[model samples]
Target: MARRSDDAEQLLLPYPTTRRQRLEHLAHRAGGIARRVLRFVLRWLARILLPLLCAAALLQAFPYQATVQGVPFEVQGSLFTRPGLTADTTLGSWEFPDVSGVPFGVHVRPEDVDVLELTRLAGRDLPGFVEELRVDFAAEVPRIAWWLVAELVVGLAVGLAIAIALEMAVRHLRGRPRREHEVRQRLLQFGAAALVTLVVAAYGVLSYNENWVRESRLTGTLAAAQLFPGQLSSYYTEQSKAFDVLGSVVGIQAALQADIDDERTPDTAVRIMTISDMHLAATYPLVAQYAANYDVDLIVNAGDESAFGTSAEFTPEYRQAIADLAATTPMVWVAGNHDSPATVAIMRGIPGVTVLGTKTAVEDGFAVGAGVVEAFGLTIAGLPDPRVYGGPGAYGADAPDVVDPLQRAAVREALGMDDDEDGATDGGAADGENGGDGGAADGGAEGDPAGVDLFVLHEPAAADEVRELLPGQVRQTVSGHTHRQNASDELQDDDAAIELVEGTTGAGGLDNIVRGTERPPIAFSIESVSADCQFTRIVRFSIESAGPAADLGTDPATPQAYGDDVTVSTVYFRPQDVAEGRRCDTDLGVGAERPWADAG
Candidate 1:
């Protein structure tokens, strides 16, 4: 009992008041508080940071589609890695090489542009249109920024929910009770995984940039190089050549314009500017500038203005541009092989533009004597390409506007169709006279109120047939299907119509941009007619290469010679010269073989 009492006394004795023991107790309490605070901070940080990172990763993995200015585009979040704008130019996907190292990429889906949109866009000039786009993009920045922010907020909310669900799923899979230490471990694991992923992605991107993108300078189509065999080297070479030619094109154009500006037109002369085979090449601006400089009174487009005679090519914008061009000077157009019946219909709809065939003849898709129309005090007639009319001898779609044979005959007769019993065309001249001299007579010349002043067709081969059909009525004949410039008074019998063949004013169409082939010079013909409707002169303007597409010599001082050839040559017409009357100071005819040819 005494021992028991003694132990109780010891227990009740004043707890040892040692300072070391008190210090040890305080340290243990402090450590517990610090651990709680650290766990709370780490938990919140993981919730926010993990979700944010996940949202960013998701955005980088997907692309967004949007349309601007009626054009479709694909936006990719590159995370400031590969910033660039690419365009589907039909020929190829072209990434603008100048813009790189940005956070995002935009790809223009040109294929998505409908006919109407294409037409609208087609009418806009390049420089001005680009400026407008720049302004529009700048104005849209705030909206785009706000949109991105909203996307981020939504993505963050989604990410947070997904992370919470995943955390619950992991706990369930482990079949373990939730613990503060486990949460900390998860946060650390997630951080490590994210860092490793970032490093791997960065390394891959760096490798790709070094191996392909940067080495190639981003000039050629990257897809083409990767997908097509034998395209890598050839494409780059072409691109290099193309960039080299641009400066030359500008310089050549300027020089040609200067020469044209210096040329004088006679006060009494009626100037006729001829262009053809545009093929939707965006050559109108250049043509318009040249026409304005020349002060042309009439503009004639021989044919091939449309590509494949598609309705899409005749957009409102394109039509408006044509109309604007016509507003400055009257325009006459003949149907070429490429100008379908529908294409012709569209052209006819444009104001200030005259589709040469008579209304009835056009409806029949044939060129008859009645198609003559008076413009600029001159009687002009056109022959539609027979190939565009479907039937026995024709090779095209049977048009809705085409009339039956009876109606066609009546229309032709009403307009002056002369058919003999043999079913061959006879007495087809504007006048009752069957055949007369082709020369333009003074007052009663064939082109007066009674005759056709200018006979126009699409192919040069058809000129002989037209001159035969029109006889002495046609003063001059024009054609352009050959995409070559030529002037000749074939047969030289003082009765042959002088044929003027203009070249491809569209510089061989827009495909030439990618063809990378040496192309013929852009050319146009200027026909100066006397006050009496007589042909005075035909001047040919052309831009060609001054020399081969290389340095003239091996010498370093020898400048590379390419696209410096700009020429303007005049061919004079003398109505009275008995044999081969047309004369040019330079050799400028079809084969450069006119008897009167002089290399001026």
Candidate 2:
């Protein structure tokens, strides 16, 4: 009886404990539970999330790429039928047009319009997932912001239904006892409901874009009808595409190549300006007068020196006439593939004016010899005007290997279709006497010569030969080999050296004599490079180097409309002044077409 009593006493008595001891035990139990739960969740997530992440990454690498369509859509709040909306652009701000009437009648009418900058950057330009992210919330959507809130409310209502269902299932399962089968069944049901919710969310987004969004917004009746030619569908399908192609073309009418320096005053510096590739004859007085209007301290031009770079339209007298006009401004000349350099030399020598590039001259801050110019402030190295890209019959895509699409088109057009129709292939046509009865010569493009690659090759000098001439002296340079109007102003630098293609004074008409209804239609580059102002303003006539990946075919008829290379004052200002959107109401300030080439 005594032993039994003692045992009961011991069992009832509690052990003495400090606060520290109690905390230790509690911590040990909590750590074990936490570790076990984390491991289980991680394991399950790894099984699903790993695969999902991998798939998402792979899809990003190969996202879909497509050009945007031309279907125009617009959204204007109900503000159309207002009163007194005179067609004036001077004082109309986007938030408030200069009209008054109904509080809610200012809606934009949708019509067919060519669109750009619409397509999102995706696997095409960025990762699919990343592209889908709306990084820019600034984009103005017509309607749907507040509506989305209501729509989200509706989504939550459906979620509440799922939650209620789950509550019912839980109550049913727990009413009696804990069953393993019941827990498993509830988990599966929860997953299915979650998936349905995700699907609905995606559907809502798609519905919003497909049904409630727009691409264009115009107000006038004439604007909508004229903008959307050939029914809305066809305009969306075809005309939009036509305009896009027009954007890629660099139409240059006034292409003058000169050696210039940006020291404000010329003559003070030995920088020589060499002009080339101007279809000057086509527009005659307009181009000449335009040149005369610009600053013409000295004008030394390379051959072709005519409207036709290789066209044999003018005889020897034509070359003489070219020299006489240039002499008015103490201009010099050199051989271009267009005329016989020997004959040109004799004619230009008449005024005691030196024939440049055939023999280097010590002027314009550099020494400009025959086929070369040597200046001090600048080493304006250049290739002989005759050193062209793709020799004789080899001007197009398949001609010994120039396969750029634009180049291919240019070569084909240079050679008349009726003439070279003898054999046509998907690749490209042969130049077959393309040089206008001059027995087409076929030298590949004036590429890097053996040792001509210089440290800084300016002015389309033989890329290879320049290296041999001044490999180390070149730090940064510019050149004009592509004949791409505003090539540099447009920032079409395919390489280094801060080099710019000689670029165009005029960007209009047939580039590379490409397939166009017009032949040698005049275009000129009124490009300017100012060091004092630290600006390069390119004022093209019909041609311009529009903004990057820009479309030049958009007509100026539309308000807030922008075109590619074929618009006047279609200016390409660069460096910094251009960034400021500087405009020249008259003087056009200092540029190739204004200060340098002007006969004044």
Candidate 3:
């Protein structure tokens, strides 16, 4: 035993006596230390990483079930920090279908949805549908909250299981552990599991506070607060505010309908409602309501009916909404800057919708040629905005030098417009693309210069060139891109005419829904024309939410729930009014209020 101990001591010695022996021994000891460090690092890494991986895998694989609005929804939660709520459908993915105020993603797969039931509820009434969604989502909040807690608990338990198993397996592989070593080993395993759990919790908290809460409307109110308790309240507040905003829209529509019902139309007057920048289908109901209530002879849309003008914007919901609106009345539209060729084509596919300055493509799913059109005992010529997409996936405006002559020829051919009054128009009937001639202008039968009554286009800037082509023929120009209502004599010149611009009818679409109380108002213009094709009057309508709808209880008979006022102004064009340059609402003299303003 003594001899063995001596040999072990000799082997374990720090250095040797001889120079060669000492050098060799030092090199071996350094290698031993490196090996030990490498093993130690690798073992620690496995201890930490294995538990985290196991926990993440377990959490992600779990299915969370939530029922909203009497609809069963199987939502899958992922630890992605994009703060998105992606709802899958047959058409494609809809991002943030209802609300997206969570740090991580929550996906509602297509198979889990009951499309028919959802459609039935939403199609019944928009405001009521939104309110139900808010209520049901709020009711489901506890389930979601508990799921979040479970994620943490599950993660910790999984980490602990992995750590304990690893420690036991290592002990078994290396033989029995000493009492002290076993206690230390157990402590190390517990520490690794706890560390992993802590890291995950910290990441979640940071992500929640950073991505979800910060982007909410209650950012100011909850910025200094912790994630729990406050976040739940913030979600409820945001949803309530969203519902109120939508309710305010319904309120605006109701107000507009009331005014339309009260208006007494003159026998010789033809009324038309002008609206534009309906970035999505949100305002289609408003437009339909106006047409239904008012005996609107026609509807002139200044365009931007889609948000990005992408094919994705043509969801079945949007298509159905526009189709229903189209069934209400005749609509003439000019494509706006945001409108792609696909957008124009979709509009063309719908009957009773006439698109200007563009030909119907195969994608339109209809026959071609629908540019120039006549409506309401008037020669109306319209041109699409220059900045619209030329083709699918292609962007940029068509060159003026290229499209100008084409539009002029189409206008002349359609109206029999004699540019030089030399008994000849610019061209014959336009071939199958620009629309066949809509007969001669009203006065063309009498050997007079065929003139256009209204020149409709998307941009006021582009109207100048088309106005120059028509000379004194155009009675009025209508456009909407500025998202502000305006009736101006700016284009009123020897060769031009007065112009009216309608504000955005969709209140900036879905993008502004989460904008926190500063969304744009819904607006439109009512233009009346006499039988003589003379522009007579324009009534502008505008209203915005002052704040959330007043909580006047749950009574359905309460009309005072809306807190905002609908501002309506009428500007008339008479020989005397035009002579004095009182052609715009801003130029209305004191006595101008005699007619429509004080009727109530």
Better of 1 and 2 by lDDT: 1
The C-alpha stretches of model 3 lying farther than 4 A from their native spots are 1-266, 359-370, 389-425, 428-450, 487-496, 510-518, 545-563, 575-600
Better of 1 and 2 by TM-score: 1
Ranking by TM-score: 3, 1, 2
Model-by-model lDDT, in order? 0.52, 0.32, 0.53
RMSD of each: 27.4, 21.9, 21.0
* Candidate 3 lDDT, 151-226, residue by residue in tens: 7467656766676677568768889664567668777767756775667667756545222211111111121111
Candidate 1 lDDT by residue in tens digits, 405-457:
32344333423435642222333334422222222222334323234557677
Can you give the lDDT of residue 451 in candidate 1?
A: 48
Judging by lDDT against the true structure, name the best candidate: 3
TM-score for all models, in order of appearance: 0.41, 0.33, 0.42
Better of 2 and 3 by TM-score: 3
* lDDT (Cα, 0-100) at 273 in candidate 1: 89
